[model samples]
Target chain A: MAPTFTTLGYLTAGLYTASLACYLRKLFAEGKWAGRAATLLLAAGLATHYFALLVRAYSIHSVPYQDLYGSTSLLAWFLVLTYLGLELIHGERAMGAFILPLVLLLLMLDFVATPHAAPAAPARGSVFALHVTSNILAYSAFTLSFVYSVVYLVQDRLLRGRRPIAIMWRLPPLEDLERMARSGVWVGLASLMVGIGFGMVVDRQVTGAMLQFDPKVVISFLILGFYVLYLTVSRSPAWRGARASVLCVVNYFAVVFSYTAVNLFFSRFHRFY
Target chain B: MSVYLLGVNHRTAGVALRERLHFSLEDGVRAGESLRRDGLVDEVVVLSTCNRSEVYSVVAQGAAQPEGGLERYFCSFHSIEPAQLNGCLYHRRDRDAVEHLYRVAAGLDSMLLGEAEILCQVRETYLAAQRAGLTGPILNRLFQAGLEVGKRVRAETRLGAQAMSVASAAMKLAEQIFGALKNNSAAVFGSGAMGAKAAQQLRSRGIGRLWVANRTPEHARELAARVGAQWAPWEKSAELLAQVDIVVTSVAGSEWSLTREALAAAMHARGNRRMFLIDLGVPRNIDPAAAGLYNVFLYGVDDLEEIVEQNRQARESEVPRAEAIVREHVEKFAAWQSGANAVAALADLRRKLRLQREIFTDAHREELAQFPAEERERILRLMDELVEDLLREPSERLMKDREVRERAVLLRDLFGLNAPDSSRRGGE
Candidate 1:
């Protein structure tokens, strides 16, 4: 039997929850096996989440990100997927404790919003799907960047303080966190740029206009400006590390606002719900 | 034969006594060979480090007895008086010796808990002993098990995983900023002891470029030459600061050598590249406020010490886990040791049983001569089967039982199967 989107989403939630538990245990425990277990569980969760999205897309006969519930799930999936890649590259699993909870939170929100999703004609066309998918993917990337920034601040504070925080050693180095965050932003920025480009094409095709004053479009451009400014000033000596991290962190909130409030109320053509 | 250990470590002796008792590699080889030649031990390995000097050996059961003799030999080899080792030297035998060596190799017995150097030292000593032909089956298995214990403890616990010294802490912090120092440059602001140590550490890390600057050009040049670094003029601090990714200052005096404003200016010139400042001076060479500057990471001696303490605590926290891993490996080695000993005992049992069969056959030779040759051969074959059937269960039990060693010993005693003395048998 074909699984419903809600069922698949719940399955991902369970896996992510278990993965989060392993990560938390790893933080307080001395055993490296916990870290390995956590990464494996997260990878398993990511696989399940991907399969869930495919099932949703198959059942609906359209891309999964066409609706708010599915879009949130996709975003959660991308966040974990990106984090797994970073964890693999860095060979650090401590960050998973921080990243997986956000993933679970998004999944929870998806579960809450799933029941309210109305039956409607599935959104069609590859460009529109590309527009939505890339935008969500960018948001996922930025979310990870924000988490890294937060960790960077905590590590910096811990390093600066007189007392030695027990968990501080487990956290990644301040510069490593910053680098990971920067990579997150760059990947996000590039993805967002592509999303916007596709959005423009979709706009022109649908409305016979080259541009629109849609609130989502404007706010995305503003988010783009925030990251562009971040990338530019972060290279400068006076603003590179902590200041740059703070900038990206604040920019991520702007991304959050645009993804939530702007999409819900103000954005006209960009509303998926 | 079993493992035996005699040693003096930081816990039991002062540095003067330890140094007096210390052995170089040549000394270790000589000692191992002399002990083996003199029939004191069948096999031997000497583990000597700054904190401790230990001799691990495989001696015949009960031979290392009167343990004072081994202690006296150790003292005499180093030309130290037995009176000097009074209450300072320790001795362990059999399982205790096995556990002690495991603990030492795993760094639990280190002066600094979980220090990694001992593991390498242990490995080197074992390899040296092997190269010198000082080890046999028993010591070979024991040292192999010791190395395995070290690796398992390291892999399974957080012990030896964190930087526990000030210099190491500084390197850790630097690595935090620059993932790998091989691509980064550093400048040391003084050529004093602290500065020299910092410069040496930076060079060891393979920093791309290093600059040593001091008030006296000669001192700076000497320090630079020692570390393969460039000697920068003391006046060129700003230019050095502008170019280097890291700055370590240990300049003397109450006056700040690198002030906030100067660092701010350097930051501007470098276009705000990230910089790490390690202040190892008593009076503090860099301004405390410079840490507030963008991309400038400033750490003082206190901060580094804090990191070291934290690391120490972290390593300390893993002790129970590391000990558990050590215990697990020790038990495993014990099982294998017993099994190995049992294999020998089992062979002896088979030999004794066959001897008994041969005796019975010789006794029946006159009776067999009266029967036909073929009938006599069949009767002999039947007697062989009877002996095999009688001994099969005990033989299998000796190999498979949990108390195989005990059973083997019991069997040897009951059958009067006295094996050859281990002293004559050497390591096996």
Candidate 2:
């Protein structure tokens, strides 16, 4: 069962790599076949990733996000799922080349870490579960926002350079990339706010204190502040486009720190097996 | 029998002379009917477009020379003198005629190489000639072959896949910027032909709102009504500038210009929303300096020309592939035509043999009267058997070998089988 889970995981990652290749092909070529191929491959990867997680949970007789490996795997799956939804909604796939690399990186981290059996941890209440779910959703949306922001900058640069290269035609226009990046931030901010509220409730119930000053908790709030400031300032006419895109890209750094360094190395209570 | 083409295209004639030769759909059908009715051609089809006017016809082997006749008739019909078309008229005969029509249908012969409009024009002209009863088996097969060539070229090559015109490039740029034109608005300055065309292109893309303004208010109103758009006062161009996502200016000799400062102010007023400006005017309508402003993309005639040149180069690379496809189809058409000609020649030979047998019996009728009626019938059956034996080898060779089939015309001439008949109308 464990080998089956590992095989499926590797297959999902391989499909994602292939899907990203297709998108990159589309970026430099004039054809719809590549775009269609990319979308189909990405969808297949998402389905396989979902099935792998389910298999792991079934074999362990517990939820999959009990440890850092399981949670990072869950984050990668959600990131792909969210990006797929965005592709479908917007009818755009050029962003896939910019996005699937982060997904692959997350999977690489999950696979390289020591494989562990299901943790025999204390039971988590409904509030703790909501906290984890919201945080994962927030992180997934922020990752997508980061991808959109980067694409926005690329598109902006191409437009500024005024070169009629094939890839410039493939990328979404500046206005569209800007709008998607902003929308992603709005959704992430809402999810993160709900996630923080749930975390506070769970923290009070578990440690009898609403505030723990854990590095992860402090960085999470800091990430929340950075995005809150981004959304507010981006709405202004003077700072709406390139400046806004730059801010979104910058804010993702704080999100990365909160999710990786603080949660993995510094947080005591937030530690997973 | 031969296929002949007579026409003047953009390559041979200037626009003034080309337009004179141009025919409306109705006029084309009439011209075809008149030519056929005059016994100039056994079958005829006329193709008239903005760039060229062509008369494609299948004529009897020794029919009246249609090239000179068509040239005179074209000039007379358009109330011009024959001398006016002396250097402009071009004539193609036989296989050359067939290949020319294929090239035209495939858009290789168009002014703008690989334009899609030529294919549709060719189709519509063929159908109209068909409807007018002016096309017979030869002309029918020729036009059908031409249409097949068009479809194959489009399918096998990317010749007509890109935007190769200024208006089309503008629309492509708009799509890139707005992602979807359905939610974007655009304004057109000046009611000139280019501006009107761009406005129509935008509307056809389902642009959210379209505003038309010109120096002449009534002209603006009329153009707006034509495209089902709103007409704004020319003075209010600045206000419209702040609202629309796109601006196309083709106002000729206009003193007014959208300066960098004014456009910057508009960008500020519109919350820094991106704006695309296309200046199609010759002397330049919009300020070139405005292109440097953030969120403002301004393209003049030169920039649009650059895009068109890029597309043209891309299309040019596919020309060899397109020509290869056309050459393949042309060969297929030639083979089918060869088989048809061979069948006709064989039929003509059979008819001539039967006629000779009848003449011999008539001349010897009295002497044969001495025989019984059954014996006479047997003699006729023997003649028929000899004719069949003589034709069997020729029939097999003609149908089975392309080289032999192509000589059907020479065979007809060698056997003195050149009497005027439908078989004489077979394509050579």
Candidate 3:
């Protein structure tokens, strides 16, 4: 018998996500550490999340991408990992202020999206691992970028208004914000490139492949295209601060549409998963 | 008596005008002497830096006598018209003069706020004037307070570090894009303070090719060559423009020396290599439009101010520590300056008692120390007690009151007492 991911799965993920969001809010609002206790709680949640994902994957003897429940669990894990990667790149523990709450929300949605798990079993096909990983990786990158864009927007607004966002003054300087936005976009672009490549590879192999002109795939490509344009504008047009922010926000929602609109609501092509 | 500070600064005058009015160290000593001989002032200290030429002095305690003596004296010293100096003059009396000195020393009255060296320069000039027997009790008290205030402003505010001087900031922007500037080439187009500072920066960063091209070629050529570069003659800058990496232009504000056409032509001639043009000149010697050229960076004072403002904001977060340092400096200065004033009262009381003793000795018709030993001891003890009693009040007043501190010069002047001069005979 495997140690199945319980409600703790959602709590662990949701707690970290919530903590990050609160920290970001505090950073912008007060420009100071709001709660070390909350930070510790989020760290604990991340640990528990790692354990849960590992246990479930071990019991199933696969990457845990078979049923909807496994997919939800994997999404939560990918989000946290993406967040930590972003933190490492930018030395921005503040993004966790926004990132962890999101992870927690997704974990809670895990409860709503997939209640009880079926008996432990290997994924239906090899492509299952490929499809699941690529989608979440790209989606997580998109999410992180959106966070950066939001901060950039807030900072930009404050600068223009000759005021401070109060909380954001604690985040980073304007240059640092610009650097963050650029870094986030770069990560997103890389993630989209890899995820799209893997999608094509797995589509050719998996039967009734999810990427068969599916709306999800279409939306994902659209999301990728948006960010590509974002990069272009940033480089050539010097689309800075505000303009980059808009692209980030729009791309984020495109990600949400790809995952939710094509998964739970329109599951025609992804029915195999 | 009002203190007066009338002078041309970097802002009000172009470099040529400023230089013409600027007094060298020798000129400064001579100017002080002339002011003394002409009875233009009772106490005079001339601050003739590149940015400003100020005369901090005490006038008769009334409206300037219309003999035009001070004006004539300055005219004779500079060999400039009284009318020409009139438009450049700003007359401040008493408190305003005191405030002006303090603010200048604090870098508040500077072209760039809170510059570090000006305060020390003011201190040095004040000390020199004192040594020259120019500064009396009033000037001494005023200058000491000003120096302390300077330290306070520099410490308590972001004025020192956050105030990115036009020269240094242009250097910083270059460093930002190029990383370390050790391998960079910086061209200085003016031989003024700002240009000199920029040159110093280039030298400090190990800049391999430094160019100091000024209208006055002789001014900074030695400096340029020492920094491992040849002096680019003012007219030859176009030929050499394509050769340098960074161009710092601070030529006279009215001149269009580093025009867009010239810099662009240089860029094109250099095969479109990246060049950073920093215009420290107020009127913008390098055209703002030049920044649009590919790989060309152009920035003026306003742009540098933007950086300063941003730095100031970040500095806001770090100000508490700086304020603490400033507060400590303020207290230290206040203590010493006030203590010096109090010591004057003690000296006065001691002098008066000694005078009385001399009178008694004459009546007794004995040697000074030959009075009955017991009587002499008693007299000395009475003198000590009287001086201490007199000093206690002034000391307590100085320690307890800001009003006294603010009016220290006037108070000292009124009492005909002085903080024993720091440089002369050891203070009592």
Model 2 chain B: ten consecutive residues of lowest lDDT: B419-428
Model 2, B166-238: lDDT tens digits are 9988888888777889889999999999999999999988999999999899999999999999999998988
Looking at model 1, the pairs that clash are A237-B271, A237-B272, A237-B273
Reported per model, the fraction of native interface contacts reproduced equals 0.60, 0.42, 0.00
**RMSD of model 2 against the true structure:** 5.9
Q: What is the lDDT of residue B40 in candidate 1?
A: 77
Task: Report clashes for each candidate as comma-separated counts.
Answer: 3, 0, 20
Model 2, residue B122: what's the lDDT?
91
TM-score of chain A of each: 0.94, 0.91, 0.78
Off by over 4 Å in 3: A1-45, A54-80, A86-123, A142-211, A221-256, A262-267, A271-273, B1-188, B202-221, B226-247, B257-278, B286-428
Residues B23-106, model 1: lDDT tens digits: 998899998898878777778999899998988887654343536667778978888888878899888987898999999999
Q: Which ten residues in a row have the lowest lDDT in candidate 3 chain B?
A: B419-428
Q: Which candidate do you rate higher for DockQ, 1 or 3?
A: 1
Instruction: State the C-alpha lDDT per candidate.
Output: 0.82, 0.84, 0.65
Error of 2 at B320 (Å): 4.0
Error of 2 at A26 (Å): 5.5
